[model samples]
Structure formats: C-alpha cells, structure tokens
Target chain A: MKNWLSPRSTAGIVLIAAALVALPFVLATGGQAWVRIANFAILYVFLALGLNIVVGFAGLLDLGYIAFYAVGAYAWALLASPHFGIHWPVWAILPLGAGLACIAGVLLGSPTLKLRGDYLAIVTLGFGEIVRIFMNNLNAPVNITNGPQGITLIDPVSIAGFRFSGSSEILGVTLSGPQKYYFLLVALAILVIIVNLRLQHSRIGRAWQAIREDEIAAKAVGIDTRNLKLLAFAMGASFGGIAGGIFAAMQGFVSPESFSLIESIMILAMVVLGGMGHIPGVILGAVLLSILPEALRYGVAPVQKLLFGQILVDPESLRMLIFGLALVLVMRFKPAGLWPSPERKRELQPEKAGG
Target chain B: MAETLLAATAVAKHFGGVKALRDVSLTIRSGEVYGLIGPNGAGKTTFFNCLTGLYVPDGGGFEFAGAPLVADAPQQAAARGIARTFQNIRLFGNMTALENVMVGRHVRTRAGVIGAMLQTAATRAEEAAIRQKAIDLLHYVRIEDRADDLARNLSYGDQRRLEIARALATEPKLLCLDEPAAGMNATETEALRDLIDGIRRDGTTVLLIEHDVKLVMGLCDRVAVLDYGALVIEDVPAVVQKDPRVIEAYLGA
Candidate 1:
C-alpha cells in the first residue's frame, strides 16, 4: 500500500494538490479570483490530457477534439437545465456526457481509420468545424440550443436533494462560485490521470506505441491497428466530454463560439508544450495555457501601468503573444514535449535517423 | 522437443499480378538454427513478411508451436513469444538504448502506464526487474555500455546488437534474424556468429536469412535453400554445399 505511492509521483501529486487547495485560501483577499483561474486551468488540463491520449499516445492528430467538448457541454446543459425540466445531477450528467462523447469520437474516427497520419488530422479538423457550425445552425423551429444565442440560465448541481446553488453551505463547507467548480475539476483531473495511466500501461498502450513507432512492425506482430486506433480516439474523446459537462455547469451557459477551432489548437498546443504521452506534462500544459491567460487578464494591466508608464499591452494580446512564442520556443527546443514517454522514446530511437 | 518451433506449410503470397511467394514450406526445430538462403527476387523477405503477418499470406498455412496461424500482426506475434529483427535496423532513433530495449519488454511487462508513471511498488519492482533484464540482454548482445546512449548514435555493429537485445526483450521462444550480418565486417560477422551460438545455447530457436553463404553454412544447423520461393534443398551445411539443385539454382544451370 505504501509502496504504490512512489515518493516522486506521490510527492508531485501531493505538492500540486496542496498548492491548488491552498491557493484559494492564500489568494482569498482578492475576491477569490485565482480560484476561478485555477478552475479554468484545471478544466483545460482535463481537455489537454484527453487530447494527449488521442494525439500523443495513440499518435492520431485530432484537430476536431473540440466537437466532443461541445457535445459534453451541450449534453450537460440540456440535462441539468429546464430545457427538458429533468434537472439531472452533475454526477449523472458527467457519465452521460462522457458516453455521448465516446460515441461522437467513434462517429468521427470510424470512417477515417484507413486514412492514416496527417489525413486523419485534416479530417478531424473539418469535423470540429462541422460540429461547431451544426450547433450554430441546428436551432431552427424547435429551439434546441436557443440558436446562436445558446442555452442560458442552466441549473447548478443537486445531489440527493442537496442542491449546490446560490451560496449553499453543506457539512459546514461554504460552497460558492468557483469552489465546486474547482473541486469538480480537481476530481476530473485525478480521474483522467488515473485512467490515462492505466490505458498507457495496458496491452493497448503498447499496441498504440508500436503503431506510432512502426506501423508495419506493429502489424507484423499481429496487433489490430485499426481497432486499437479507434479505441484510443473514443477513449480520449470521453475525457473531453466529461470536461465539457463541467464547463457547462460552471458557467451555466452553452455557446457555439466557446468550442471553436482556436480552442482545439489551444488544447493541442497544451498537450505538445507539456510533452506527448507524458501525463504530468499534459496536466501541466493544460493548467498553463488555460490559467495563464486568465491570470494575465487582470494582472497584466496593472503591471504594464507600473512598469512601462504607458500601456503597451492588453491581457488578451499579451497572453496570445506569450503562448504563441512559448509554442514556437517549445517546438524549436523541446520538440518531444516537456516530459516525454521514456518507453516510447526508446522504442523509436533504434531506427529513426538518429537512433 | 515440440516437433518444430515454427512451421510454414505451402505458403503463397501475391502482389497484384506478381507472385511474391509460391507454395513455400519449411520446418524450424527447437534450438536449431535454420538458414533461409536465396538470391534477390527469390522471395526471401516476402516469405518473412508472410510469416510475421506483415503481409498476410493469400493461401496455405503457417504454424507456430503446433498452433495454427492466422493473419497475426507483429505485436500479436511478439505477444505470442515470436520476435524478429528487421532487414534495415528499425530502432526508435530518438530514444536512448535502454529505452529501446525497454519497449521490447513492453508486451512482456504486465505493468500498465499508470504503474510506470506512479512508480507503484508492483510497477516499480517489475520495472526494475525489466531494467535489469534489459541490461542483461544488452550484455548478451554485447552492447551493455551503450544502454544510455541514443540508439541513433550507435555504430553499425552496435545498432545490430541493439536490435538483437530488443528482440530478446520480448522474451521470445523463437528469434528470427533478417540478415543479421547484412552490413558487417568479418570481425562483426564473427561476433554475430558467437552471439547466435550463445542465443541457441540459451535455448532459443533461431531462423535466419543470410546472403553470405559462408556465414550461413558456418552458422546454420540446417540450411533451407530457396529458389524463386520454392525450397530447392534442405540439409546440413556440407550436404547443401554438395547438392546439385541448390548449386544449379544459384549458378543459373
């Protein structure tokens, strides 16, 4: 039991969790703004982590990952809100969103299985645009998503008649804005970490890496390359779905603009910047991209006024510039990612030009 | 001990109008090194492709350890205790030597990615044991010191040796070498001979394809000469050397 917690990983989890948990308390003076940023960042970590499975571990570049995210958010909104008047709980919506996302993943990945490599990426990118446009255009006569304006005033989660909404205190804990969101995001991040770890270590993981390293070699060994790739795609998409569900609940709104192609690129950049197939790196990548912009939003203005005398940068522009430069620098230097999969790195080195 | 470690019976493969393999059949026994020797266009590599399930055979059957074979892919073959080195050393170049070997053990290792990431006791113990095994394998293939170096940095001989180690990482019962001595100096070839003998001594059944007749003859317990995808002769080195059919096929009658 004790040994399962390898000091390094255990310590890492402990440190990160402690830091995240303590951040809200430490930064409590400023209207709990950092917690909101943390929530946003953690949610993104989940998205990036999911994409890492599809893009990094499975070696399938998915530019349409945001579609699943949208699916999840919409699914959550429709279920939790008065849209249907069912008012499903967050726990219930989470799995439902994930299941829908998995199905969506299969739908997107199925026909493209035979395409291979960059072709799959382009197809997925098209799929993302398709999903967003579909959401935008789908609300004609019935008003399913409230059209381009999106479904608003979604209900907060209720568990066993215990509702977490409009500042409720449960078990002596004051649950308010970004608090439940942060908790939910943390839980999801942990779950993703665990699941991705399991997937990578299992027989399936080896098959994925084999395909990545050498498709011919993998086939020669009797691996079902097509099915395995599909499984990876679906599995990765499910995580995106879960994150989307939480996103809907946190904001109490759903909009087509939210899940754009830029969102997909941002997620991809997060995965790449952190390191492909490295869970910790993926997590880090997510938190950085998602939270960094939010932090810069409020902080950058004051810093600019203080340091430069004249305001030279806004939060959005500076954030974008920094992230873009970070991506460029990462690609220039650490192409394999921040923390690469050691075993994967090994399997390919023997024959690839340098190996 | 088990009749033969591997057996391909009347195997046939075709690419478009051209026939790559034409009803080729051969038996490979335990601890015995069977050499597949043939000239270009004789379908030597095609036979390998068929056997390993890279190119599924169009007709006929191949069996491993008395089990009927299917279009079993390479990773499946690796799982089923069959390992092979490629003709052109296909190592993961960006990875270090140790990592390359570790990947070979990937199928053999039961620990999942989580276990590796978390460094769980079960995973850690298993990983350590595997690391040791990889080290031993490197030592066996005579590339122990190069374990930390990137695979791309290895010399030709060391790269070949690393491939051997990677194959051994699968803990394979039957090891196939596709031109193990392909681009080697005589000394390296001699070293490979020792390595093959060592592997055989350690109880692995080896099936090798070689262009160098002398190396094939010197190393093989039995030689199966292929002429245009047909087994022209199967005998000991001396007997194969004396066979008129094999000579005629090679000498063009």
Candidate 2:
C-alpha cells in the first residue's frame, strides 16, 4: 500500500492521465482519422474486458463472442435508426440492447454448460457464425438488419440535446466529432474497468476462478457452477452490448460485415496477448492490436515505395502478414503473455522448469 | 446415548457387474467420531461417495439431521450441512490458502454480481466478515502464516490441512474426511488425529474413512468394518477389533 502511493508511482499515474487527455488533440494534428482509430481501440478494450470475464476468469473458451456485439448494434439500428422510422434516446436503447444481448448470452450458454475446452470453443464458434448468417438473411422475411447492404442513417448518441456527432466549443477549444466520442469512449471504458476490478476481487470473482481451477472441487464447496457460468456469459455479453451500442452510434451504421468470425478471433487475441485475467494487460492488448494494424495499413505502402523505388506487394496483405508474424513470435516466446498476472506467472513457473 | 445424526438403511450401489456396496446399513450418532474401514475394493470410497452425493446409490437412502437427504449433486449435499475433503486433496491450486476457504463460504455468502460490482454497504461488510472468517479457519488449522500463499505451493501436510480448513469454512453439521491421512508422514498423521479430535470436541460430528487401522481405532468411538461390500460388524472400537469377522476380512480365512 505504501509503495502504491509513493511519489514515483503517483507521478507516473499523473503522466499517463495527462497523456490520455492530450492524445486526441495531438492526433487531431495528424487528422481526425487517427482519432477515429483511437475511438475504435477503446471499443476493442471494452470487448476484450468482456471476453476476459469468460475466457480469462472463468476459463470458458468462447469463440463466438462477437455475436453479442452484433446483437447490440442491430438493436440500436432497429430502434434508433431512420430505416425503422424510430428515434429513441440513448438511455432507453443502451439498456434494451444490453438486455437483449444478455438473453442471447443465456440462450447460447445453457446447452454449452456441460461442454468444456475445445468442444466449448467449437460450439461458440458455431454460435457466432449462426448470428452472422441470421443477420445476413433476416432481411427477406422481415426486412430486418437490411441484409448484406446494412442499415444506414443511424442516429448518433446524445445526452439532453447535446449531440456527440456535432462539434462544440469547450473552454474556448473547439472539439471535433471524433474528439467528443473519444472522451465518451474513455469515460465508458473507465467505468467498465472499475466494474472489472471490483468483480475481480469480490466473492463472485473467487467462485469463478475456483470453477476455473477445479469444477468438481468448486461444486463440493457449494458453488452452483451452472448458474455461475451462465452469469459469466450474461455479464460478459452485457459489456459487449454496451460497447456495441456505442459503436453503432459512433459509426452511424450497422453491418454484419463489422461483426465477423475474424473480429471475434481478433478480440480474443487481444485478451490472450494482453495477458489473460489481468485488466491492465487486457486493455493494453486491445489498444495495441486495434491500433497496430491501422498503423501498418498506413505505413506499409510508403515504406515499400521508399525501399524498392517501385510499387511492390499489396500493402493490405503485407499489413496482415506482419500482424500474423508478430502474434506468432509473441506466443512462441512469451506463452503466458507479455504482461501476465502474478497468479498466472506462478501457474507457469513449474511448467517452465519441467519443459 | 446421543440421537442419530446420520442413518443409512440398506444403501446399495453397483458398477457394471461388480457390486460396490450391498445393503450397507449404518447409524452415526451426533457428536461422535465415527470410522468406516475396509480392505481395498471393499466399497469404502463407494459408500462415502454415495453419502456425499458424488454417486447415486442403487437402492435405499440417507437421513441426515432428521431429514431425508436426497442430494443429486455435491453442492446440494454441502448446502444440507455436509462438508467433505477429498482423498486426493482437491484444493483450488491457483487461489490463496485464504481464498480457498472463502470459496467454501460461497453457499453461505449471498453477494451476487450486482452487489459485487456495486459494493453496497451490506456487501462490503459481508465480504470483510468472510475474509476474517477464512483467516480464522487458516489459524485453526495452524497455517495462519501461509494464509496468502498459493494452495499449490504448500507442503504435502499443509495441503491436507488447507483442505480441512476449506471444508470447515462451510460450517457443516457433519464433516466427512475421505482418507485424510493418505499421503502424510507419521508426525503429520499424529497432528491430523489431534485436529479431528478437536473438531469432534467442538460439537461437529466427524465421519472418517481411513486405511490406518491404528488411527481409526484410537480416534473413533465407534467403528464399522466392511468386507466384500457387506458390513461385517459395527460396535465400539474394542469390541469391533475383537470380532472374528473383522480379523478374517483383514487377515485371511
């Protein structure tokens, strides 16, 4: 406790806070595109934290987590978009979307309760694809989801007539649309992080970790493993739902393409790469994985042009290749993760010696 | 004589063609350290598992604390005030010694996800009480110094003690120890005998399943011996030891 409040640590915290506050302004100089990427990165942080509750804490391997995100996005699209000719407020839609996604989570979690490990992963993977396919085909019978073309003209998030899409002057500094959304995303992310931290130390958290360690022992200790596992799924899905609501408002669109199998894998990669069961590591993983690909997308063409003096391999494919290589290298070297939790580090210590 | 705390009438179980337990009727009175002993494959563990809800008996049932006990799951058994430690020491390895015990308090604690996230005044107080109780249990097992250590890192004897502490956290009416001294050294086994005595003296009924005849004879007030999944004799320890059937089962025909 004393070391936590030391001058050096306090100074480091203040420095990080200042940097977070100034990040968008500095990126604004590079243009609003970078600010938009930052917003998406924060969105990814929400998804990663949500997934961590299942995969990291409870040790349930879910491969279809993005289905919940899609649920939230479509919920917003149907009720708050011009396509439906309805415009509900943010407060009403956010919770509704979250509730719907929670129900979906429970529906998916029930049958899979008896499944574990790779089998659970396979079931969740099928669930994710099922959602995507439903979103794609639901257009014909009900004209819902707008099919492959997607829904447009979705209303932006607003509080008391103050629109996030519209720029406003604050302290004589004009804030752009993306800048405004960035602050909103940061505030929501902080709230989510607080919830995660609280849950991590609570009795419920301990039960989840117990089940993860040994399910039979946990049950023997009187933990209702089935209900608790369902709670994990519902809670994690609600986070995805909230993030999905914000995402729909930010992008002003809803498309099945945005919530793909690849997106679920990418969000999962964030949780695993950031260090499973560690909050700070997960946030870091999400931010880096979200931003790094964009950075490569922008830098690869120019670097190729400079090095070869001619156009080389496609920049998009090269960006993915580099991303894949980075992931492989990280996993091969730091199997537990780059910033693993202390408990996880201890779990691996003996294995390291034996291997 | 004390009232009956646990009564098993004609409890029978079988696996495939092998009969694991056959009409094993037993009565355990309150506030007594009862011992269940048998040779290998004599259905000691099978009967223990049936009583704890790990396995469903083929016939008959159990009455615990004057109520018919029908537990289909281990959690159900625990909720009915029956706590147990495993033969293989199944502690939550990644959790701290204190946390392992706190998990035992799960059925007693009522904090849900919302209360945990909100950290309401009542929830915070309950959490503190739980932590303090877990710490006290660790102290009871004489491992207060290792309260924060991971369960997996504890010594062999400490792991067994930790499992006992974890079971005690459930505040059970009947504590079932499945081969508690299985892998312990002589000194550790002696300490365990004293702990079991203390637990029974404190008014919690103990049901011990052990292979160590000496420990069982010394600690148990009444003993039941099983041979070929059938009860040979159940009486006071001295009387059971003098029984010819018990000698034949353990020695030879």
Candidate 3:
C-alpha cells in the first residue's frame, strides 16, 4: 500500500515528517518562536507546488493567482467566522473554497488563454489588481467586507465536537498555535508534491508540457491546447484556494493585505528557483524562499544592531533584493532551474549523464 | 478499382481574388508512394495543406478510407490517421528526440488531466509502454542513440529522419511528407529512400511532396504529378517519364 505513494519519495516524506513532528517539541524547548516560521514556510511550499503546474508545466504565467487565494480565504472567512453568523464545517468549506476558486480560474482563463506569453502575464497581473481593488471597494451601498477594514474573529476548525480553539489540549499536546499548523501544512505540501509528480508522468501532464513546449506541434498531434490551458489554470488555482482556506483558519482573520501582487511574484520565484517541472524542486524552492527572509531577519537584525545600534536591513527590503538577484543569476547560470527536470538534465549533459 | 485512401474531388481554393487551386481532383492509393510535384508558385504546398486540413478548401470535399475526410481542421485530419511533416522542421526544439516522438503518441493515450496528476496506475502503465514505443520508433529510424538529444542540436539529415520518426510515432495509416529530401547529400538520400521503402513495407501508405526530380523518379512506384494546382498525370514512374506533360511542366521541354 505504501509503495503506491512513490518508491523512494513516500519513504523520504514519511521519515522527514516524522522527524519534523518530533523536532518542534525539541525546538520548543529552546525558541518556541521558530515554530511559526516553520509553519508558514510549509504553507508556502503548498502554494509553490501548485503554481509550478501552471507556470512550469503548462508555461502560462499567472500574475492574478493570488486572487484565488483571496477567494479561498474569503470563502472560509465568510463561512466559519461569526461575521456572517454561519459556521460551516471545515470539510465542506475546503471543497467549496476550491470549487469557487476553480470557477474563478476558468472565468479568468477561458478568454485570456488566447493571448500568449507576455501579454497573458500582463492580463493576469491586471486581474490580480482588479480582484483586490474590487474586494477593497465592495462597500458601495451595503457593506460586505467592511471596506478594507477586513473580516476578523474567524473560528478555528473543529473535528467531531473537538473545537481546535486556541485552548484545546490533547495527549499532553495542543492542536492549536504554530506547531499543529506546521504538521498540517507539511501533510498538505506532501499531498501537493505527490499529485504534481504523478501528473508529470501521466498523459495529460505530457500534453500540458507539450503545449508549453510547442503549441503548434501539440496542435498538429491532435491535442486541444485551449482546453488543456484552462485545466492548468483551474487546477493550479484550486491549490491556491486550499492554501488560502487553511491560512484563514490558522490566522483567525482575513485581510486584503494578506493577498497581494508580491505574493504572486514570490510564488512564481519559488517554482522557477526550485526548478520548474520538478515537484521536489518547487517544494524546496517554497521552503527556501519563505524561510530565507525569517532566518535572515534573525541574523541581519543582530548584525545591524551591533554596527549601528538599530535595525537597518529588515526582512522585507532584503527579500526584494535577494529575489531580484536570484532570478537573474539563476536564469543565467542555470536556465532550466536549480533542480531542473530530469528530461532537461539529460538534454543538457547528454554524453555524461543520459546513458 | 479501389475507392482510394485519399480522394480530393473537384477541390477548389481561393484567397480573395486569386485562385490558388481550381477544381483539383486526385485519388491516392494504399501501399504506394503518391508524389505531388510542381514548380514554385504552382500551389503544390497549398494543395498539400488543403489535403491535411491546414487550409479549408473554399469548394469541394475529400474522402479518405471510404469515409468523409473534411478539409475543416488539422485535428480532424490527424484523428483520421493523416499525419504530416512540415516543409520547415517544426519539432519541439527544446524537447528531446524521445519527447518529440512521445508527443506524437499523445492522441493514442486517453488519460485526462486528473487521471494524469493522480497517475491512477493505468496512466503509469500506459506511460511506460508508450515511452518504450517512442524509443523503439527512434531506433527503427536509426537515431536511438540520440534519443535524449534536443531536436535543434541534430544534423540536418538526422533532423529529417527524426521528424519522420516523430510522425511515425502517431501511428499514421497514411504519412504525408513535404520535401523529405530537400537538403540531403547522396548518401542521406539513399538512406531516406531505403527508409521510405521500409515504411511502406510496414503497411503505411505514403504521400510524398518533393522538389528533387531524380529522387522522386527513383522512389515513387506510381507518381501523381501536380502542376499549376492541378493533377497533371497519374502513372507509373517509367510511363510518367515518357509523358509529354510531366516533362513540359517540370523539365521545361
């Protein structure tokens, strides 16, 4: 049964997850604050893996992807939070959020898919802005989102009379705070990776890559390129939705600032930096990018404090510099990506490796 | 008489005021190489495009394998086992020789996006088998050693052969080759002739569009000569050599 997950990947993920679950307990002994960073990093991993399918495999650059995340967060926020006075189960909200995001995905992709490459990118960028502005200005006549004030006091998920409120203790362990979120996000990341890997080896996956590689050749071979692009858009958005729903429940709040254009760029960076078309690369990219800022935040603030007696380089400023440099250097040195696809690696070093 | 694998009956095509092909009609037979030969501005490529549904004919219908083969779209032509190579090589440049072939095998596999993402056991089994089949086609075309090479990196002769391999991976009942011997040396041309002969031996009917008169005359068993967007003659190679119209159109007699 375990063999089905992936030969070595299943074993690696299980061992890693088990180690991680035991780790925070060990790390909590020293700095409990590190657990929050860990949790959010895993969350980023899930988002990265999903976005990889669109930009990496399908070769469709999506700048408005964060809108799906917003949709998912809002879906959960409107449902579980007392702002609406409606408490839907987590199980129900997850699918509902994904489905809503998928619908939004199809709506966005159906028309814009005809536009290729850079034009498509610009359109999606506009879309992300449009969604954010729409959400921000929805307080025209009747107030819905409270006009940029945002929704708050979202309830935590509960399973079978077990409200995972910030106060529940189980088996001498709590299911709230950053620790539980870390474990849950890791599981979600693994799920996303498995799905991506499986898709890469499957026929539809090949078709998407084919369409990505050469639209004319793919069309000549009888693939309906339009429908395939739409599928990538919707499926990729569904992951963003799932991640957003999880974010809403974990934060116990929903705000416009959380889903921004920068968030979309950050996710794209993860897919490219990690190596497009490689699931492990995307996950690694997600973790590296998400954790880099915080780890540097801890390291840089101290150095700045020692030199100038004040914090000079903050995490936000450093992230932008590093992100820009990384894109340029990475694309130049390794155009395929850090962890390039097996197919790409073979093509790159035919005499040395492909045999 | 056979109804023919490909029949373009009273086919007419026009772009605005100019007529590209007027009332072009021809019947293509199975187990033989049918040549469409014409000088520049003679609409040979245009006629080939019409046959493959690249350009929808303004007038007339086509019949292939005793069923209606409408000149509506490329996908329709592909679905009916009509596979073609372009005049300019259009293989996925970044993709490996093997992947170029695998894309050709795509229509045969019916796995959907979700089924692919999940790898539903069936997709896995199908992937392995098809991958092997692509490798086999490369081997058959004498380029198995370069299966992992990027298509653009190949020598011109090998690129043409690789294109053929990719088209063959589609499992076409009838293969349409446009200028298969356009830029090849004597040795490569002979190898291509052997390869085309072998492809016919494997039971695939070939429709060849070539500019090389010697290669065309040597390879084709029965030639369908196209001149000025019309079928000039349909005869055995020797008979066509003796025909005045074939000589007048191409050799400038």
CA deviation > 4 Å runs, candidate 2: A1-10, A351-355, B251-253
Name the top DockQ candidate: 2
lDDT of each: 0.80, 0.91, 0.82
Q: Which digits, one per residue and each the tens of the lDDT, describe model 3 over residues A270-319?
A: 88888887887787788888988887777777888899999877867986
Each model's TM-score, in the order given?
0.85, 0.96, 0.91
- Please state the CAPRI-style docking class of candidate 2: medium
Comparison by DockQ, 1 against 2, better one = 2
RMSD of 2: 2.0
Candidate 3 chain A, run of 10 with poorest lDDT: A346-355
lDDT of 2 by residue, A149-200 (tens): 9999899999999999978998999999999999999898888898898899
**Clash number for model 1?**
30
Evaluate fnat for each of the predicted models and list the values in order. 0.26, 0.74, 0.58
User: Which candidate has the highest lDDT of all?
Assistant: 2
lDDT of 1 by residue, B166-231 (tens): 888888888889998988989999999999999999999898999988899998999898887778
